[model samples]
Target: MDPTLAIPLLGGLSPAAFMRRHWQKKPCLIRQAIPGVKPPLSRTELFALAERDDVETRLMLQRQGAWELRHGPFTRRQIPALNQPGWTLLIQGLDLQVPAAHALLQQFRFVPEARLDDLMISYASDGGGVGAHLDSYDVFLLQVSGRRRWRVGPVKDATLVPDMPVKLLANFEPTEEWVLEPGDMLYLPPRWGHDGVAEGPDCMTCSIGFRTPTPTEMAREVLQRMIDALEAPEKEPHYRDPAQTATATPGLIPEALQTFTQKAVIAALNDSRSLACALGETLTEPKAIVWFEGGEALAPGQGLRLDMRSKMMYDADHVFINGESFRAAGRDARLMRQLADQRALSAQECAGLSPGARELVEEWALSGWMHGV
Candidate 1:
């Protein structure tokens, strides 16, 4: 949960130094980044999860120069035989379902929660791979089982093959190569081309991806939130001009109205509480394919911790859990911030919460987002 925990894994580099020098800037191949790192789920367990309709999964098969992709909620029989070659199965958000995977993800908490995505597990047969590709967001590739041969480079040509299900780079040129054994990890910044092929049977890799919102996407979300704020009845304030000269050019937008709009926008931006709420909610939203198992409310005085499956974040004035925001203040704000930072509220901290905050925590527990400390 702190910088000290990362020392052994990062070759004694302080967390601050790692963040400043290497994070999202270049690549680092750390041998045994996680000592004795094992796959969170066994092959049978992973296959069982893939059978559930709620789990997001995909199967890709390449044979005889032909590629085929299939969506899953697959039955056991649906899985191809292990003897088959050139096939891969991917399960998204494994961390959300497995405690060990969740614990693994917490090791990267130095990065902002907003940019942290989820763990994706890929199970591949011998010679299986998704092909050479570049992602727009940062990624950490950790080898969990068997062996994988990886080739990587700074891709000059980002062009994709004309008609393929995968966004494969047409001109992939490898400048570096490595064969990863269990516990090895490779971190790559955005737009770095990489390809990995299973060296033999039963190769599994865990990919931790970061969120990268484009400017246009961010602007759209912010503008929509602004419009929603403008429409709130209690906050609405109309433009008023007591003395106005009637202009011959009626098509011109009224100066008072324009000024009002500009002020409204600025006001929205300046509202720390609102901005915090929006950012937190957006970051914690469940993936489209994710759902939760509702449970009973917590008893009073019970401590709380985030469900390993849930995402929570906070800012100075608000806390976000599972894509919803709550206005927070006073000791509640401090406590919630601590929870966001550490992902848990200790028994002592829970005892200090106000009755109102305690009630909210109980509600979150019932929603399966928080658990007893």
Candidate 2:
């Protein structure tokens, strides 16, 4: 995808321009963004996905001003009747299960892959809604079918309603309002308050959300990965106090030990490249519930593509796939980065890899992180 090329997906704003003007900055609503777009999955298909144990789903109902929530591997009987008012079924990570959903997600390649998350679908009955709420990540809400009424604004009060199963604003004020039809879309930055209600039965919306890791969360994740990736030294170093003096306070941390601890951590962090490697690996780590079945190795001269569920990324000196990091350079590095960016390699590109790199590709294929194209 060309970042500079304007597209209907962004209301004729190029990806580069959208990133500059709207991304994480404010909201942009576009009518007919997809123009004649249809829901990727039918109502029956979506309900079936919600029945699978591996899929994350939720059911919400608001009846007579009372809100109720339920978790699912829900059956059709468990779902509210079609004519029921103020009820909704939400399915998370649709892109992980459906190829068409994944293809729809790929249209937003303007964002970096590390920040790209997953697509969620919400199917709502008339008057259905999750209530007013704020999210800590960027989102694009696209109307897939029927109609939805949206009220959105910058959040001033961070207060939440008491004792609710879902986080809902105690006081929500709408600065703007719109009724969206099929193919309409709204882009919102993190922490913006929004409430959406279905106008009629069969209201379906697709939410393309991006990952937004807080500083503490990011540090804890990457630091833990770095610690796990540490290699054992040839010889274990022991602390010694050859010039020790007897201390009256045995409970106190010794100054020498404190200095030694700091030095040890500093030494580990001194290897600057390790942090980069750790970050790459962390960014590409697969979802907790995702698992791959092993398969046969790739045949020679075959084209290759990443599995739909695979998470692949790269930094300056390392390529990361399925939470594993590899050092890459020269022609191999170039080819690997291309594979990461394009998610596929042509047969000619595969043929150009060195013997070792080719073997590595086969290993990935066998592990089911990628497949023959």
Per TM-score, the best of the predicted structures is 2
TM-scores, all candidates, are 0.90, 0.98
Can you give the lDDT of residue 151 in candidate 2? 99
Q: What are the Cα lDDT values of the candidates?
A: 0.85, 0.93
Model 1 has an lDDT value of: 0.85
The candidate scoring highest on lDDT is 2
lDDT per residue, candidate 1, 1-373, as tens digits? 5764547556566678777777878887888877788898999999999998878899999989778889998998998999898999999989888898898888888788889888999999999999999999989899999899999999999988878888899999989999999988888889899999999999999999998999898777756664565446686656778888878999999988898889877977887766666667767888887777886676655667888878878776678888888888999999988988888988889998898988888888888888885
Candidate 2 per-residue C-alpha lDDT over 1-373 given as tens digits, one digit per residue, 9 for 90 to 100: 8899999999999999999999999999988999999899999999898899999999999989889999999999999999999999999889999998998998887799999889999999999999999999999999999899999999899899999999999998989999999999999999999999999999999999999999999889889988988987899788998987898999999999999999999988887888998888889898886889996788877999999999988888889998899999999999999999999999999999999999999999999989997
TM-score of 1: 0.90
- Clashing residue pairs, candidate 1? none
